[model samples]
Target: MTDRHNAFLSDMAEATRLTQSGRLGEATALIQRRLGVPGRSPDGASPADASAGPHAVPRLEGPAARLGTEAAAATAHEALIPERLRENIDQMMQGLRTLAPSLRGLVGGGLHAPKPGGLEPEGVETEGGQFVERSFSNAAGARDYKLFIPSPRSGPRPLLVMLHGCTQSPDDFAAGTRMNALAEEEGIYVVYPRQSSRANAQRCWNWFEPGDQGREMGEAGIVAGLVRAICTEHPIDRSRIYIAGLSAGGAAAANIARAYPDLFAGLGVHSGLAAGCARDLPSALSAMRVGAPGAAEPGGAAGFGAGSVTQNLRVPTIVFHGEGDGTVHPRNADAVLAQAGIDALTPRRERGSSGRHSYTRTRYADETGRVQVEAWSVQGAGHAWLGGSPEGSYTDPSGPDASRAMLDFFLGHSLPGGRG
Candidate 1:
């Protein structure tokens, strides 16, 4: 959305809050941003029929214009709600709430999120010239992946394939997360298989659809194929290979694990849900049925089964989410954890003054108690990558650390067997 539009919504929200909260003067001023004293009722004089005399004049032009301009100033206080003056305020509200953020990058110069430093791979020069932006044709490369590799050493290193969320591109995700530096630091190979608009206008991973979330074919298979191809050329530790993503991408990571339990080593899902629980518009609506803010729609029988991603997922996993997230509910973590059946174990629930909530490092195991599923939670954050670039969406860095945990988790495990 344009800054003007964001400002308009901000005015409406302020006016609504002040009016409801009994602050009429402030409310009036806020509402005036759009209404501007109702344009003087079409009369030449006060309370007269000005249009009848062809001399209708605006009532508060001088002072009211000032009010509109002031109310439109930039502030964190902005909320996308149009004032009552607009006949279609409800329609405007959708843009304010749902569409604005998606347009954030388009409107303003995509500024780096809060602290871009510390979040990226520091002290290292770009390993190879620039990660050659290239693609190859697999079975039917309907979708191609943008590849990024670190200093390509002969020895196989771990591979990290990142999936982009809805309305995002591989380059966008890379620009926001700067994962290339991290790949260089760890000597890891990375692949970002971009989704096409044909699959989704927004280019989302399509993890929300039931048909796309399984191993049958389509995106799921392409992703698997991409991983296999990378493993073939790169020195990726088969057991150590992993996947990670933000929202829909996060859901896809989980879905991939379920479709091919033996392939990936772990997942890093931020602000997303497990596979099966939500697929397609109907199921997505169902998963979001609960009336809680960002809460998971308690699962259905068709959701991830006991031995699926939850049980058979022999790899350890880590999750990061903002406690105050309004997009995807934090409670979905419980549902994702539930699918993994983290029933008996409790990690540690670490927290700080800021809202960062982490799970008690619990292990999901089979009858023998071998570690399988693992997770972490961040508090007081909103839909975002913890300690990620402010340039990205749904990210907050000032809380329980997530970037540190992600790297630690990636380093701790490699493919279970030697290049299995």
Candidate 2:
């Protein structure tokens, strides 16, 4: 093997170890530098801009230095990161390249990176509606959120809580999904909760952690608290609240919705895994690569922390996944559907095209013929918000309009005694 290839492998192994240790910032920094991304310092901060940049990678010492030796390094590389995982690692790094520029502006209190299409910054009042910023704090913790209130507020409006993916901010998410634009059309309220980098270096929700997976705890508690606070302050209908997210955010949305079924009437999970799919970094990577182990067996919901997975979904749910998504395997989408134990034989299927991409949509109904779960599988799309705008990050604009579809599905159902 070439010496250069060996060095690359060594770095890849180290990056994998860092990721397993939950030091994603350092791992991101190392990977970003290896990719030759400009404007970033070795510590993962941008020299020109403190707000956006990669997280710093720390030097190995003592016990950590064993990986520097050829023998120990080989063993660690072989044992911890198998040959099969290399492809996934490469794909993830490539995704980082696309995400790096927007990332510098997203972290800490840095100025937002410039919007691609010269769009207005997030939370700016536009012609369509008023975008307002707010904060919520409870015993669990505190979080910042942006609320999009439609221009014409006639009565109690339905609310949608949006969670952005890693390396994303509320404004970036708003621009990508264009959910705020849809809110203007439907006369509803949309809120995007900002995940702080202090909680996670990449600003991803701690979905794989045991504490964050259950109801009234960790990130779930904070998000639920935010929703309650919004409902109390605004003219929101308690019965018509919903939540949706993408990638890491998507997994979090599943956990939050499942944890607090009483708070959310419906859920939209795009390119996400099932709730409690993984309890740690190793299992999380495994679940993202494949479906959660034993997820199909009866009573397989153990190790899910406080709550066990139930057979039926308490809240109406819809899912979206790209067939070509490399960062997260498409089977995770199936796992999300499988969590509800929907019968495989009953779904009604349809094939359609959204401008450039082809898609297959499957709908599953309850005994009353109410569509309780829906899945959209888009062809040729990757780990991005399908049919999202180019103005934001991590979006593919040519696929099906997931924002609109999710809105339609969410509006179709409400809590009991609610106007559906």
Candidate 3:
């Protein structure tokens, strides 16, 4: 272990000692400093200066060390520390039976850790757009998310919840989708919820986990709480709230929409499976390989519950999948439509080309003539964000622009009562 790792561990031990002695305030401050939050240490020195002093340990050499560094450097308010570190902290706190409730909350709660650099994407200017880092916590869990507000807002604007794929950050996803630029043009607000590596090794949303797939539970509940918090703080048109994601994030988006249909007006999924398509890792892999039949159907053996499959309401959904996507099969898009209770009643087909890739879009509408679900099958495209910028990963700049299409579809629909 490097000196820094040792110092971090040692700091934890010292905090435990302080807590046991009933000096909870001091203990909390120490922990905050160790987390790299800007604060004064007990010795009257700044956290940065204290870390470089003789008592500070050098950085370690391992995954644990890397996690510590990342956790300290993370800007997201709810960014989670490594599970092992969290467990240790929890145990230490437990030993301090007399610690104040608020102090304990600070130690155990999701705290903010500002990123070493700014949260804004590099080389991309929104002109009048603003990016803010925020956190939301509830009984389910806590999460850190970024919100983008476009300039020149005359009234309550629409809100778009963008979930990132596995191994992708909010900044990276924003860059790849170029959604910020679109939001600026449309005067919309965009929010991106970041998944922690501690949550999943690849930083994928726990969509496949039973604990996370339900309403008011796990990741779903946390994200919903975040949405509620954002709406409460911003002048969001509740009727126009929408959610979309890519890959694992796409699957998560489906899960969120299914669980909280009233909260979201529509959904956009890219290269993703339907909700409850898998209950575990093995089943998730199976679902991705050939598509899980009846995975989203009511009362199916693989179904999570009755609520897992949409019953009363059909969330307006738009799906995009590349025919050549090897990571997630194209048939999964059909499964998504089926889960939304959309019937294959003669789709309006449209073909388009961007640079080298061509795509075929088929729109499926309900009896009322409202397009409930649409699928885009990009020819010769792989598993990537269609027409995304090259600055980010998992993007094909040649395919149809998914961000623009999704925004157009989202703005067209609202809740049944139209209550914005």
Most accurate candidate by TM-score: 2
Report lDDT per candidate. Answer: 0.56, 0.72, 0.72
Candidate 1: tens digits of C-alpha lDDT, residues 1-420: 688887565555544433433444434434434644443331111234334221111111111122333233212113322444443543444444455444433332121121221111211224462343334344433454566767756666787878876655677577667677777777777788877544664456767655666674667777887687667665667887888887778878878877776787777777777666654465554453331222233233444454232332434677765556665666666666755555544443333444444433334554555555556555455666666555544445455445456666767766557543
Task: Report, for all candidates in order, the number of backbone clashes.
Answer: 29, 4, 7
Instruction: Sort by lDDT, best first.
Output: 2, 3, 1
Task: Report the poorest 10 consecutive residues by lDDT, candidate 2.
Answer: 54-63
Off by over 4 Å in 1: 1-129, 136-141, 289-312, 344-346, 353-372
| Candidate 3 residue runs with Cα over 4 Å from true position | 1-127, 295-313, 344-346, 418-420
Residue 310's lDDT within candidate 1 is 38
Winner on TM-score between 1 and 2 is 2
Per-model TM-score on C-alpha atoms: 0.61, 0.70, 0.70
lDDT of 3: 0.72
lDDT tens digits, residue span 1-420, model 3:
688765565556556655554445546556766765445554334445455332122111212322433333333322334556656656756854444344433333222332232222221223588765555568888766778878757788899999988767787789889999999999999999988655765568877877887899999998888887767767788889999999989989998898888889999999887877777777777778888766445444345455343333388899999898878878788778777776534468898887788888888887777788888989988788988998777788887899999999999989866443
Question: What is the TM-score (0 to 1) of candidate 3?
Answer: 0.70
- Residue 59 of candidate 1: its Cα lDDT? 18
Clashes of 1: 29
